[model samples]
Target: MVDAAQKEQLIFVTQKSLRMNRKKHFSESRCLQLFAEILTVDSGLKPAFLFDYCLSNAEQIQEYVQELQQTGLLSENLHILSMQENVLIINLNRIIQHLERALQENGVQVIDVSVHRENPQLAETWVTKQVRAQVDIIWKHLKSQVIQTGESKPGLVTASEIFSSEWNLCTMFGFLLGFPASYWFDFNTSFENCLSMTPLRAFSVSAFCPRITKNLKHRMYSFSVPDILYLDLQSAIKTWQRELQSDFQTQTMFSHLCVSTESVCLSAVML
Candidate 1:
C-alpha cells in the first residue's frame, strides 16, 4: 500500500527513533553509575556526600534514586536532602549519632578552648553556644507528638524532613561529613567562616577509564583541607587514599576504572 519512497521514509524514521532511545538510555545509565559510585564511597568513609557538579535535574534524580533503591544500590536509611542547587545525600542516623558524639566528647567545646587565650571562658562559651545551636536546629525540626501511651520517644526523621533551608542543611552537614577538624559557626547569627581568606588544598580522586564512553570517562571524589592544617592532616589524607584504592579494587563495578588523586590549591571563598 506504500510507494518505495514512502517505505524508505518510514525506515529512516524508525532508525532515528531507535537512535534517540539508545542515546537516552546511555545518559540515564551514566547518571546512575555516577550515583552508585558516590554511594559506595560514602557508605564506608563519609556520613554524607555533597555533589559539587549538577549531574541531572530533580525529576531525573528522583527517578534514578528510586531505581537505585530498587536495585539495592541505595540504602533505606540514607536520604536525598536536596536536588535543586546541588545533590545532598545524607545518612540520617549517622548525622544524629555524630552530633551526640560531638556533644559528649567536647563537653563544652569541639574545637578546643585555648589555655593561652586572653579569654578562655569566653572562647568556651562561644564554642558551646555554637554547637548547641546546631543541635537545637536539628531537633526543632524533628518535633515529637504525644500519643495515648503517654511516653515520648523519638521517631526516625529523614534529613529532608528536618532541614528546610540550605544554610541550616549546610550547618548540619558540616559536622557529619567527618572532616578531621570541621569549622562550625552559628548560621542564625552569621554565615561567615573562619577560613574565609585561607588557602584550601583540595585532593581529588577519580575512577578513570581510558576506553570508556566519551561522556563518562571519570567519576571523581574530592575534599579540601585548609592549607595551614595540611601538614597535620597528611596522614589522614594518606589513609583516605589507601581506602579509596582498596574500594576501587574490590568493587566489581569499578573494575574497569583506575583510581588516581590530584591536589590543587583553591581559595576558600571559591568553595
Candidate 2:
C-alpha cells in the first residue's frame, strides 16, 4: 500500500477500444472523452483513473491521440496507479444509499420515509438510539472473521450498517419504515418477493422467493457459456421423480414435466 498519508480514491476505468466496431468506435471516441470528464469533477473527493497495458486503443490499440486532446478535463491530482498484482480494488460502494430519497425526488411512490418525517429531531438517528449503537457491533462481528481477510484490515462500514446487524433488527426497521430496503432498493433486479405486492402490502408470514424449480439442467449437456444442447426428455424423469417424492408443493410444480404411463426424460449434447 502507498503511504498511509496518501488519499484514498474511487477509480473510473475505460476500455482502450471497443471490439465490436473498432474503426467506427475509434473514430467517434465520445466514450473515452466522457470518462475523463467524470474524473475532472471528482477532484474534491480525489478519485483516480488508470489505463491497462497490452495496447489496443490502450489495450485494443485504437490510439489515445484523442484522449491526449482533452487535457483540461483530466486531473493529475486524481490519477493513481498500483504495481502489486495481488491487490484488489472496489471502484466505489453503492455511494448511493437512501433509496427512498431517489423515489421521492423522482416522484415515484414511496411506502414510507420513516416516522422521522413526523419528528424532525430523529432525522440522523432514525427510529432508535439503540439501533444506531448496533451499527458498530455489527461491523465488529462482520470483520472479526471473513471479508477480504488474511491481512490486518481496517474496519469496513457501508452505509447500510443499520439493517446489517441481525434479521430481527432489519425486520424491526421494516415495520417501522412501512417497507424495508428489500421493497425498493433495485427491486427489479430480484424476483424474490414476487408474490408479495410490496409498498402496497405484504404477506404476514415470510414470502418464499420463487426460484427455477426446473431450469432443465439435465436437458443441458456438459458445457461452456452459450453451448447448444439438444433436449431429450428421457433424462428428465429422474429429476422429476425425485421432486415428485419430495413434497406436495414440489410434486405439484414438477407434475407437468412427467406423465404416469410413459414417464419421459430429456437429454442434450452441446453443439
Candidate 3:
C-alpha cells in the first residue's frame, strides 16, 4: 500500500531524525521537541496520530533508542522525551543528524582505547610505546629516575620512578592514554589507601569512560586488573584461575601502583 515516492520521503525523514540525534547536546527535553517536529513533517501526521502509531509499536522503538543511548550516541534529552511521551516515536532522522554535527564541531574523539588492550601482544606494544614516549619527554626536561619492568605478557610494561622536580608526568601519561581522570591517584595514596577510599572503591573507573563502555557493549577488546596485587606468582596464578570461573572473565577494575623498591634512576622502558 506504500507508494515508492512516499517511502522515499519516509526514508529522508528518518535520515534527518538520525542526523539530529548526532548533532545535539545532552538535553532530554530538547530531544522530545525535535522528535515532535520530525513526526509531524515526516509522516504528514499530527502529534496525536504519531503518538498513537508509536504506542502501537512501543517495544521495538524503545529497543532502538536504548541501543543508541548505550553507544553514547543518544541524547539524554531524547530519553527524557521517551519517558514523557509514554511511547518512543521520536524522529530518528533529526536526533541522529543533530548528534553527528555536534560531535564533529566539538572534535570529540570517541575512540575505544580498550580495543588496544585486546591482543596481549598489541596491548603490550601500545602500552610500552606510550610509556617510553612519556618517559623520554620527561627525561629531557626533568631530573627524574625511571624504573621499568615487563610483565610475562607479551607487550605489557610497567614503569615508575620519582622525578627530582615536582612534575606530574605519570598523571599526564595516564591521561594521554585515555585512562580515567580518577586513575591519577595522589602520591600519598598507596594501593592500600585506595582500598579504604570507600566511594572510589564503589564504582569502576571504566564506568566513567564513555568510549570504554561503548567498546565493551560492542564486544571489542577491553582490559581490567585487580585492585590488589597477588603476594607471589602462585597467588597471582590462583587469582587468575579463580577469576576465569566467572561468567565474565575480565576484571572490571584496574589499579596502577608505584611501589618504592629502590632509589632514583634516570630513564627506563619495560617492554
Candidate 4:
C-alpha cells in the first residue's frame, strides 16, 4: 500500500490518461529509483513486480489488467498501457487510505499509513533531478566493472560485446545487491542491427548456430561437437527476458548469456 503523503502528485493522473498513455518521464530504471525511495520512506513496503509494456510479457499484462478490472479490483477507466508518452499516475495516498479503512472495518489489519505528510513537491523534484543522476551513477560504475581485455584476446571485439558488457555488469550488480534491472538498453531488444538493419544478426546465425544445435541434438550419443554457440543477440535477449524477474544465480554459467561464456564453455568441454 502507498502512503498518505503522495496525494498532491496525483494531479498528473488525469482524463487524458483515458486515451493511450505515453510514459515519457519514467523509464524502468527511473521507476526502480522511485520504488526504491518509496521503500526507503516507509520501511515496511516491499515491491513485488511492476508490469509495463516494454516488458517481454506484453500479452500477459493485457490479460492480467483485464481480469483485475473485470473483477472490480481495478477500475475500468484505469490506464492499462504505459506508452512512454502519455500516462496515468495514481494517487497512492488516497488509495491506501481507502483500502486501510475498508480492511479495518472488516478486522483485517493493514500497514500503518503515515499520518505526518511531507511536501509532495519534494517527490516531484526528486523524480525530475535525482533519478536520472542515480541512473547515471550506476551506469558509470557498471562501465568500469566490466572485465577488461587486451589486444591479445582472440577475436576482434564486436559492438555487441562492448555494449552487452554493461548488461553483464548490471547482472552482476543486481546479483550482488538483491535487485534485478528493470529496463535494459533498447538496442538489446532489436532483432536487427546498426549495419542498416539488414538482418545481419540472423545471417551470422548460419555461421556457428548449426554446430551448437548439432551438439545439443546429438549430445546423447556422446558425439557432441567441441564447439560452443555464442548465442546471437536475439537468442541471448530471449533468454534474458525469460529470466528477467529471476534472482541472480551466482552459480549459473554465463548468466548474462554473452559470447565470453560460449568461449569458456567450449574450451572447458574440449579440455
TM-scores of the candidates are 0.50, 0.20, 0.16, 0.17
Tens-place lDDT per residue, model 3, 1-271, is 2245543443344343343334533243333333333222222111111223223234444444444343333232221122223332332223233223323333111111231222111123444344444434533322121111111232221122223333233333332222222122223433111222111111121111121222221111122222222122234333322432231223222112111122222222111
User: How high is the CA lDDT of each candidate model?
Assistant: 0.45, 0.24, 0.28, 0.24
Residues 194-214, model 2: lDDT tens digits: 112111111121111111222
Instruction: For model 3, give the 10-residue run with minimal summed lDDT.
Output: 197-206
What is the Å distance of residue 98 in model 4 from its true position?
Answer: 39
| Candidate 4 lDDT, 113-224, residue by residue in tens | 1112120011233332333344344334333322221222322111111222323232222211212111111234432212221111111010111211221111000111
Candidate 2 Cα errors over 4 Å, as ranges: 1-24, 29-36, 45-73, 76-183, 186-271
Arranged by TM-score with the best first, the candidates are 1, 2, 4, 3
lDDT score, candidate 3, position 80: 14
Candidate 2 residue 154 Cα shift, in angstroms, is 23
In candidate 4, what residue range of length 10 has the lowest lDDT sum? 217-226
Q: Write the per-residue lDDT of candidate 1 for residues 1-271, one digit (tens) a residue.
A: 2244543443333232222343442344434344545554334434556654344534444444444454444443445555236556555555445455555555222332132322112234655576567665653332221121124223221334334453444434545454434444445555544554445665555443322233444445545655655676566556546655654665443334443434554333422
Clashing pairs counted in every model? 0, 17, 38, 6
* Predicted structure with the largest lDDT when compared to the true one: 1
Error of 1 at 66 (Å): 2.0
Better by lDDT, candidate 4 or 3: 3
Candidate 1: global Cα-lDDT?
Answer: 0.45
